[model samples]
Target: MKPARKLFLGARLRRLRRDLKLKQVDMAGKLGISASYLNHLERNQRPVTATVLLRLAETFDINVRQFAAEGGELAGPDQLSEIFSDALFADLDIGRQDILDLSDHSPGIAEAIGRLYTTLTETARRQSPSDTSDPRSLITPETWVRDHIQAHRNHFPALEEAAETVGGALANRLTMIDTLCHRLRDAFGVNVEIASSTDLGGATQAYDRSRRTLFLNALLRPENRAFGLAYQLSLLEFDAILTRMVQEAAPSDEGVARLLHMSLANYAAGAILMPYGRFLESAERHGYALDPLCGEYNVNVEQVAHRLTTMGRTGAEGVPFFMLRVDPAGNVSKRYAGESFPFSHYGGTCPRWLLHLAFQTPGKTITQLIETPDGERYFTFCRTIERPIRPTLTDDHLLAIGVGCHVRHASRLAYAEGLDLAKGMATPVGPACAICPRLDCAYRATPPAGHQLAIDETRKTISPYPFLAD
Candidate 1:
């Protein structure tokens, strides 16, 4: 029998050593190996022995399987190669050896190059009118926030409990605002002032800590002012808690981390404005109706819908729902999932989905029974909400907010009224045109990623690119 082939794991060994913040000599001493042998192993001149691998695992407190894995062992090199394959590098006659040599010897430079290309690609993709199916497209701070939200299943019981702890007539919307206003004045000796949008520079809320004043954009609809107040409260009252949450993320990008912190603070604001128990009870009583909930809570429809998804308190759970808000250009600004829906992390949603049509009937709730490529059925509803930057600004900020739940729970939704869901009368939709596999879809923007392009000169197919088998 042939002996097991020795593993040439140069990159992994180097990465492990660097991650431990140890020099070659220090790492070699810890592993009970000579520094010269370690250097040879790190340069792929010598194979990693089983004994050294065991020592590595024990010393680094890492799994042996990590070293056994081969795919990401040279991921920097592979990613650098992919970066070169972009149109920007099309004119250059770059070779495999050049890429490998640079990545292996100067991994820092290789990583920097890869990051530059990804940032440029992401910036271009973001400028496009449509949300992209590119996984890298969600590289924005919003995606990171979505990740943390999804990890918690769109619920933060701690935020809810914290809101409970900061109670001041929170059961009543008007009373809660009054109480928060009092707290703002009494606790911080700060006066809450509403100013014109121009004065506030289109910001929903801004705080002047030195002046001991909080400025809210007066252009915001009256229903939204409470949220602005709550947002400011989160920043002022629970800043340490908020900072702790952000620190837990330990994001490398300060800008992205700051944005994520703001997003989470907004969540805390919403959670406080609508304390969980009272809001949850009202939601169920109102059949999860956005308008009634909005009226009941004195908040906007977007706030009510957003708050509904955060109702995932264990044992006291609401109907599992997903919410998506897309701008007119098809950029998804907000996304939350209570169940596994076909939401693409990298790209725009299916054009055939009801939200695009909801734009036509602006300010009106539209409902439809939709099916994903995976045959999952949901009862979804959407309506457009205007978010004008200021009183003088144009109405380009219209965003369509959609919320849906499984067909099994559709009966509980007011939007699913009078729908014959049993007969399988669901309109098929998917994550995005680029990644969707349904061939008959007329609105597909691009060919599916996994399928090959079979452009027939002699014949024409219904779809633009005739999809061939993988």
Candidate 2:
């Protein structure tokens, strides 16, 4: 028989303990081990036994396979390799073992370095003529809000509970909109009115607190108007809850705080409209068909896509999905994830991904299997969605929304039906062009940041900018 391989899961165990918010002693007691022994296991001084691994899986409700996997989404060796491959770090002698040690032992510092590098590259790409030395200057309110939302895996339990309560009260009504309008008037003495696009001056919805009237743009679709009402109702019903959550997010800038407040309210609105438990049941029963769910819930495509990312309610969790919304110009306006998608933290996403191609076929749903450079595969579906109409907006303002999950979960999707997932060829994609190491891609927009171009007068290559392999 072949010898059994040893399992050194120090880093993963430590990260799990931190995620559970447990002290070393507390975890040790639960594991029926001494704190010193647990410390040794966490520091890689001892290999984890099979019995101990199973105990951990049962104790914490974690996946044994995922916990035993090397590296992680945030501090993976691939991410560190990409960051160090930049020309700015060319002077430093960073070996593979050195990167491995940093990623395994001090993952937090590795992730922090990755974030700083991303901020630096983003600042440079924009050619911001201001201070380029301090990368922190490039951190915008949106970045802060995005990071905060991602930290929670896009789930807010406090808002979810409040939404469920509100949803119960609105049940058995004639129509959601009528009930919402009546609630606004009876509960809060706030009248709802549909105003012309010209009257709103290009805003989708406006609240006049002094007049106690909510003016919604008439051009909005029925679903959006309902959503606007739910959003306003959430603000009124859960002011203290939203305020507390915003304070917990602790964004330094007031702009970031306000953005977070609005985001929380949006979460509440989705929960109130969809009502978590019923939505999850419907999603599973229907194989997560977006259109069917949208029709059943009276919501739009974008709202359904966003709600899918927030199904992390523990014990009733749905397949982890990451969603991205981008305009025709390649600008990503919204992103939420329950699973890591390796999004471009610095520059534009890879052109080969289906999200960009979704713009080519308007109103049509498209699906593709993509493999990141790290060899992780995902099943993706994308479609064009119409945004709420504004007076300044024209027909050209269409956006593409893409939702995806790991290939392991592909079988659960209706869109993945009749597809050979095990043998399907996946399109290879990079997180971004500058950090990509693939020299054979003909569509590469930029050379790898730190690699040397193999310029030769005698030979032409298929790739426009071929570089020497590391």
Candidate 3:
């Protein structure tokens, strides 16, 4: 038989034993091996045979393949190879064996260098504006959305159903808000106490550790109070269900997975308040109207808009919706989509879209059909809602929140209908910064860094122009 391949198995076994807080004598006794032999094996002075390997497997009750395979431990050569292959270290000229020695002996240093490289890359991506000249692009918004969706595999049927049912039940009852609060307290064993600012003492929702109860400040607007109650209930009741959904999705990217976890938690809260089937039924019944949904659910315009976009819960999926919320200064606060919405990589939003005009009519809602320069048309509605900064506290400030959705899904909405979205009514929209190159755009903030700019001082084009090469 071939000489038993050692392959660092003995060292791994020794480490595992030490980790389990077992001594050499104890390990040897358990394995039916002499202490001297075990010592020799651990020190790499002797190779482990099949008999000892089998005994170790039996004792640990683990698969032999896992023990044989490098269990989170990398060898000197493997570590060195990874370091050498790293893009940041491509310029470094070092001997192979030397790199291996450093990796084996000074893994901490290697890890530090790797982290530094990652940090530098991230910083560069964030700071660089021009995409034409810069090679490393920060994660695109579309990619981010895609990853978020993939992480959850678009499974949230429970949330959709919940949002629909709860939304409908709250439609007709003036005491519905009180009833829902009672249900939350009864189901979750948590009291729903709405006290004044003095009672809450500056906290929006205070969780009393001793009493094991929650206190909501009464200063919050009616809509916000309902949302807060539902959000808390979601944490209490649906956390395990959300966890199982994420686990089933099995996200590959760590960052995306973390975001998805947070997003799902938020979704569960919204669903608990809105309930999918009822919400959908209500939307259809109300002719996709926002005002009635808000009054019915005791939620704000923004909350209703957000909840509407999340109707993509499995079987009873609503028309694939894309939602975007931007401030008056063109800062995007929230963006979620069931359909792909092309976003700019760099600076200001497309000027032609009603999102900009919505700010002009702050409290009023405007519905419009938007078509991008690339001929992608969407039915969009824009409106601003005042959100209290500190809902339950005295220091609360009212901030205007903007909300919009894709136009194709607008027929079901109560907003302006019978508008021809397909008749090319939308103006072209492009990325705000160096990422988009619409030559005729009057609102182009900066020339796309990726394109070559030809400045002719004598002949200024209508737009801050860049030369399109053949």
Top lDDT hit: 2
lDDT of model 1 at position 43: 85
Candidate 3: 10-residue stretch with minimal lDDT: 70-79
TM-score of each: 0.70, 0.87, 0.62
lDDT of 2 at 40: 89
* Candidate 2 ranges with C-alpha deviation above 4 Å: 1-23, 38-82, 93-97, 118-138, 172-174, 390-395
Best candidate (score: TM-score): 2
Sort the predicted structures by TM-score, highest score first. Answer: 2, 1, 3
Q: Can you write out model 1's per-residue Cα lDDT over 125-233, one digit (the tens) per residue?
A: 5765243454443356665566656645677666778876664344456566676778789787878888887787768778998898988877777767777777887
Q: Model 3 scores what on Cα lDDT? A: 0.60
lDDT of each: 0.73, 0.82, 0.60
Predicted candidate 3 versus true structure: per-residue lDDT over 1-470, tens digit per residue: 55533454554666679657999999999999999989877765666677887898788664454355421233333333433444445456445557545544444455455444433545566775334232223444334444445223233566555555555455344565576677666776677777777777666667665675778877777777766776676666667766776676565455545666667766766776667777778877887677898877667787877777666543465665556667666777665555445543223356777676766676687766766554567776677767543543463233333334456566666664666656745666654544454666676766544345778888888777655631
Using lDDT as the measure, what is the rank order of every candidate, best first? 2, 1, 3
Kindly give the stretch of ten consecutive residues in candidate 1 with the minimal lDDT sum: 66-75
RMSD (Å) per prediction = 10.1, 3.8, 15.7
Q: Give the TM-score of candidate 1.
A: 0.70
